[model samples]
Target: MATEPSPQRAYRAACPNCGAAVEFRSAASALAVCSYCRSTLLREGEALRRIGQSAELFEDHSPLQLGASGRWQGAAFTLVGRLQLRYAGGSWNEWHALFDTADATGAALRSGWLSEDNGGYVFSFEAPPPEALPPPEALRVGAAQVLGRETWSVASVTTAKLGAAEGELPFVPVLERAYVVAELRNAQDEVASIDYGPASEGRPPRWYVGRGLQLAALGLGGLREDSTRELKGRSVECPSCGAALAVQLATTQSIACHQCHAVVDVSKGVGADLQHYAQDTPGAEGRGGGEPLLPLGRSGALALGAGGTRSWQVVGYVERCTLPEPGDDEQSFWREYLLYNQKAGFAFLVDAEDGWSWVRPLTGAPQLGGSTARWQGDSYRELYRYTGQITYVLGEFYWRLERGQRTVNTDYQGPGGKRLNREQTGEGGDAEVTWSAGAALDADVLLKAFKLDAGQHAALQRDVKPLSSRGIGGLAGLFLFLLFVVIVFSLVRCGRDDCAELRSLYGEASNEYQQCARNTGGARGYGGSYGGFSTGGGGHK
Candidate 1:
């Protein structure tokens, strides 16, 4: 078995290929990449052996680096190594962080992987082997499976190749070799992953469980200062229209041109692999219908958490339509604007006919019970369910999106004008669920935040009023006021003597003619006799 090594003092070895001095910080590390020649070297007692060459690390917008120190959960750790992995869509960094804790034997030190995923970071530690492991073929994305005591839903299953490595690592990693990885999330937003080794290696897959964390929570220092500036200022001309387009982030895969409205694929870098839809002509499919409510490159401050706010820029915009069932002719649609920030990842500003909601993706799946779903201790009632199809897209996105892409959406209503949305793509076990929670915002507030003119877009002029407590209170007050007016009118009419006399006379008329004669006789020219009427009160013939 591979075991940890005891702490060694002042360990240094000279590279055999380039004769460059290589330093080892952890005694357990068996391999190190040469800083000067980029050669992979293995340590054998007192000598260093050259194994292979390391690939060059790509320039990313990440602010983390080796030698940076930070604290996590009251424990301090230092970033000592990194493994850059590339996938079909993009690449990510798995930073090897060495903790202050020691192993069981106290001979070797412990380490973990801090992976950068989708503009967020996840810290994971190796967990104990499960009782029984499932084969790769048996696992599917979005399927609920039991691991240990927690029921987890698979979020993604992807294959990644080792692009590059630096500093030290606990195990030897093959360069350019592809491996399988499965990521799962539970109801509490906690994340777990399984890293399956290359099939040829015959090594058992490893499991890890951890939580998602923000960059600010790490309290890291000595990060690369120019990372943000480089990413923000990066620009390239569109291959289709030749218009200069600015790339939003280093990880952006697709960017749509503002002039020609063509979706450009930037996975191979800017101005490469551009594609456009056949129906991308002017005024087709509501493409050129109206201006966007929130224009691209506009920024606004949003309150994300307690005592903290983040400024996010509107990077991408997409309009999607929800068609009624197969035979129905009615169609409904909404618009979604993608918001991005370096530290906050991505958020969405959703505009529908009902109202506007600021949405952010949830880290975990909410627990569903019958017609209700619970998230963060709050229950949401089912609002509506429908299918959404992509109509148009503009600006940059982290994922590859195309027109006519469809998704099944379920919306739920929560307390305080909040909304919970569940969107699923694909079917059966291969489906993917994306959950988002949002609160309704006024149209004026949204426009003011983005500094947009209300009259520019007709959509912005129409505000969808939500059912709020204050509005309900106003309705209740109006109902009570009308009731009070009816009661006052009845009392005033009763106080008048004329109304009493009329009511008495009407009561008597309701009886037979005898009662009428008794009540109104002698008052008029008629006498009290019912058969014949006397001319006067006496016998005045």
Candidate 2:
């Protein structure tokens, strides 16, 4: 005790596979994945033992690296390790960030995870260890689980594999090891995840809860430069129609033929066994042959509240239909044009038979309970819940898209007739939820914004009854009012001299006029012939 404990220091050893010097920053780290040779090395005393080769990390656009430092909640943290994980859809990075703060004993270290995917970044911290965790079987999707005092709904449950690892990690990661992760979401859009490593090892699962973070908040530096520029603006010929399509984004997986309306798979790059679906022939019943009102590649400026206006190009089009459920006989459908701006992401302009709507995807999850939901402080009531089918598709999509895709849709209406739509895909525990909010727009506004030919998009003109137009009833009332005014003016002018003049002109005929007035009554007194002229007269008072 008097001599004091030796300060823990970094040690270095030569990799057995590549003979390259590898440095381990933590004295407690027993294993390190060699960055030079990607060999799994076991640190035994002062020597390194090569175990196996690790898979090389897949290329991506992430701007992060080991040894990068950042501040979070006024605490300094360093990126010490990372685990690349791949799921059924794609791959993502789970960075192990070690905080500078030490515990009471100062012997243990604390760390968190920075999960980065193509969608965005999510920062999470380990929750207080629970006395016991529910079994994996009990974690059902959409079911509620209590953590501390907050209740979270299971959003997704997926099994992912460890693709690769780097830097000094607190625990050893076995290459190609499979782990179950159950993601939970709260009403506030807060996210939590439970990582269940092999339960046969008899270790308690880990729990983490946190919110999504923007890249600017991380203060990250020394990021790898993105190489997607080389892939952008690449052209690929459609396998079905042979029309050349310009791939706008490197991340695009599928595109539709502009000429033939065929869906083509381009994930393997252009000319590499591109798979395509033939255009669906119009059936004798006349199903699935609707044309888009807005042409693809048409760019329009959209006003985004305080963000001002930005131009978005129409990149994709989908015609979706909602048939009456079960016993119902009504069928409704709508057309949705997908717009994209490289900096602003995706948006939809929906053309329904009744009206048009401009919709944008929601980042914040809405609070849903029963048939009601609250979004951005506004409450919405459920309007319709139905299954939507993709009848036709054109242009490009970020993911693999196909014809006849179906999704369960629930729509809501809020203030000013604003719409909140929730579309769910997949089934059972693997369902994914997407929320979009929009408001009704006039067809004229859309036409002017896109600068489209009004004649060509005549179908987009909705049969909207003018709110101020009261039909023939208003015209009839106006005519009656004008006639009453004319009659009153004439009576006032004629009362002064009209009766006396009639008596002077028709002296002896005055008696005849009086007789005519008496015969015709006061309202229609003048209807007899006088001096070969038919004179119309009224009763004199």
Candidate 3:
């Protein structure tokens, strides 16, 4: 069986600033940061440093194991695996789970248990945008740079994770807990990462592991750390400030100095595709130092439909979305696609730059004036509610991210003869109604429809129960068949008439006579023969 990360060794580190005793977090890595001065201190690589006063401790209040249950938005949710990542002074952890929503008011959803961690948690979908997050603050800033473009009134979201760590970003613990110390390394194979938790002896950090990749750790009272493949090798060292920095391989084009925060355009600085460093250094540090390097790669995650239309959906860059509409001008900026599922009777419009656009009309209740509605907590009549039938299998959702733009053209039509179609040509945020469209509403209002109160979500699932067809008719038919079978068997007995009187004559031996009838064909008289319908016994006649 695969086990978690291995145990980590504790060490004391000098406060690079105050010279007061400090410590290392994990057993690996060369440098250690001073708790008092926060100065970046390097070790002689691959050697143990010193120790200091130990850190604090924290208690885990949750007993939730994998697959635990919880209640949210009036629905029950199943616990998925958790994501835990450690970086900087603290770490972040996130739980990936799924909830089954039966109705809009969220009353039909199940309530699963929840594990709350002060260490850190993902922002609730309902929480207001934070101060530093970029796209969410587009309202205040006239125009912002995102996905390689700048736009006014663009829709954007600040993601807390990058690369593989995107799934779970760990946050620092509010209360103290036991943590591990580790030695970090740079791309050029230098000993860089350092950790300090419980076991500090008042000195500097020294220890090295892994030529490439970053680290993943489980923090308890004691230290535990290990190497990981999640991190890309590209690391940064500031020439001006000498501060070490980690380069996020996913979206970073330039290296930002950790101390000075100077943005370094690596392409201009280095004339090569990747950078290199020496493997040897002094003072127990693994690799001494070398020129910083960064990779010129383009890799980004997919965001499904955030907005759409009657016959289609609008998706693409955050900047292309005009917050509320996709004006005809910005339509070309985002890549588009159309998707259809005949079994579920649904369609999707995917915009590469924005997100996904989904639609499913309800044929069950045919009425006058077919209109699009959204799914909200109280009613399915809201704007997020699509007029349609749906079956979400194995937690798969109606919305998903796609690679490029494609459209589905079908004979199925919507209100006023609108055919099933996906088009990229539309006006800002929501399309302007000038060409026979309508006003685009706010995303928050639509998102609110998804928010479920704990109890309401569970209630909606209870009302609908599964049923089998044919009802009592199936039972009655079975009983009558059995009765008919018994009558036919009795008529085929030995004596055609007055069989009961014959039974009285047989007295206590009647059962024996019946057995004889079954065993030896009963002389073809009072009882029937054993062989059925073959002999000319009265039973057969």
Candidate 4:
């Protein structure tokens, strides 16, 4: 125990202080200033040290992968790519680091310009903001350079379980192949974007372009299809006896039903072609810059450009729903007229306190959902004001979405768009609660609740539900139970034949439920794929 151990063998360029063996993660890996000698060894061959510059190639896929995630505020984003850089003054170098977008905690993913080369392949890269640009290591691409290779072709991988943000995002180890591009540039000032290949193999590539991709990429949901995929939702109708529909505030007075070929009155909803007007705020290129913010609750009356009209608490139009730089590209951020649509089912979250950000086809949500205002998703619970009838119902306190790893409860922004509390639903999987109050449910939230998949857009005529007849059914169940007990009692006290008949009747009733579960249509994806804008869209977005 008292004997001193032999020193470890060092590389050819051994240090004078500690002759210990050393190893680096990547050949071109950036060097950490040596603590023992304060020296930056030039990494050559197996010799670890400082690195030189060369063009780095974007692999077909990123080395970094995403983990489990929920919505952040009103948007949904996942951790997909990461790159880190160290910038001292105006110059910088990259590091072998982690770009954790899993929870969208640090720097955001900005618009990455994309272009295809003559070689039939397209490439993309996100340009970091102009903050003396930190080396790649800061974002966690890892500080390392190709010892000889200038480029890398990122290949296959081993996945760690995904729900880490709720816990610890387990790092997936990667084996990489590198290559050096002949030329490269800090194309931030140039075009920036990325492509999401076809949502369905039957459609064209889906490109989510904007300054912030998190929102631009969350395609719509609830469309179901089969092998011979044909699009639906072009027309809507009344659920009862197929009929053409119309809504009170729609620009279009009528919508026909394709299925039942009937006429349904839509004097209830808004259509895509409806001309929406907002205070003329500036748009791209210094449009609304320096414009005074439309003070909250200061909006005037709105003309729907249709026969029906409604007044709104005009909060000014938002300037940049655009995802921050390193986010999205062309035609993203825009000014929108935020208002409550009785026909459509979304809450009119008048004005976001910060930059302009627009999510498509604005839909309503309960201040929360199926419960108290607290029961709604993060975006619904704290953002909008209640309009319409208030009905008290008992539900739970949980949101359908949230941003951040489910495990590590970090600082998440609040309803006012400020970082506030943690997203932990105290109910573990059982946070069932009971509430009583009048609350307006967003049309969109109701759609999700009632399983009304499609049809009925023009007539924003809210569907109604009558009380269940299950109460009468419950009394019948009690009568049957009492009879069965009496029969069994009499059988044991009297004859064998009586006991046999009771057993036979019980077996026949259990098989009915097993038959109904086979044809139910439902969501197949944790988030399903879209048909892209090409195939008339799966109506996803």
Model 4 TM-score, 2 decimals:
0.18
* Candidate 4 residue lDDT tens string, 311-416: 4433222222211223422111112223322222111221221222211110111122232233123432232111111001011001111111021111222354
lDDT of 3 by residue, 1-541 (tens): 1122222433564554577764432333244434454343455454423332223211112232334444443444444333333222112333433344422444222111121222111112211211222222232211222221211121111122211111111122212333333221121222211223333334333221222110111111111111112223445565555566554321122343434433343322223242322211110111111111101121112222322322211111110111112342211112112222111112222222112232322111111123431121111111211111110011011122111212211112234322222122112221100001112122232233334344443322211112223454777667756754453343222112223354457852456444423332211111110000000000000
Output the number of the lDDT-best candidate.
Answer: 1
Q: What lDDT tens digits, residue by residue, belong to model 2 across residues 423-495?
A: 7666664455556677877778778888988785555654334323456477776775675445333321111
Q: Name the candidate, 1 or 2, with the larger TM-score value.
A: 1
- Give candidate 3 misplaced runs (Cα > 4 Å): 1-8, 45-541
- After TM-score superposition, the amount by which residue 412's alpha carbon in candidate 3 deviates from its true location, in angstroms, is 22
lDDT of 3 at 456: 43
How many clashes (backbone N, Cα, C below 3 Å) per candidate?
Answer: 0, 2, 124, 115
Candidate lDDT scores, in order, read: 0.66, 0.63, 0.25, 0.22
User: Each model's TM-score?
Assistant: 0.78, 0.70, 0.17, 0.18
Q: Model 3, poorest ten-residue lDDT window?
A: 532-541
* Per-residue alpha-carbon lDDT of candidate 1 for residues 286-374, written as tens digits (9 for 90 to 100): 22322466878889887744326778898887666565687774455556788877777777777665566777766677777789988
Candidate 1: stretches off by over 4 Å: 1-10, 270-289, 305-307, 426-431, 454-541
Ranking by TM-score: 1, 2, 4, 3
Candidate 4 lDDT at 271 equals 31
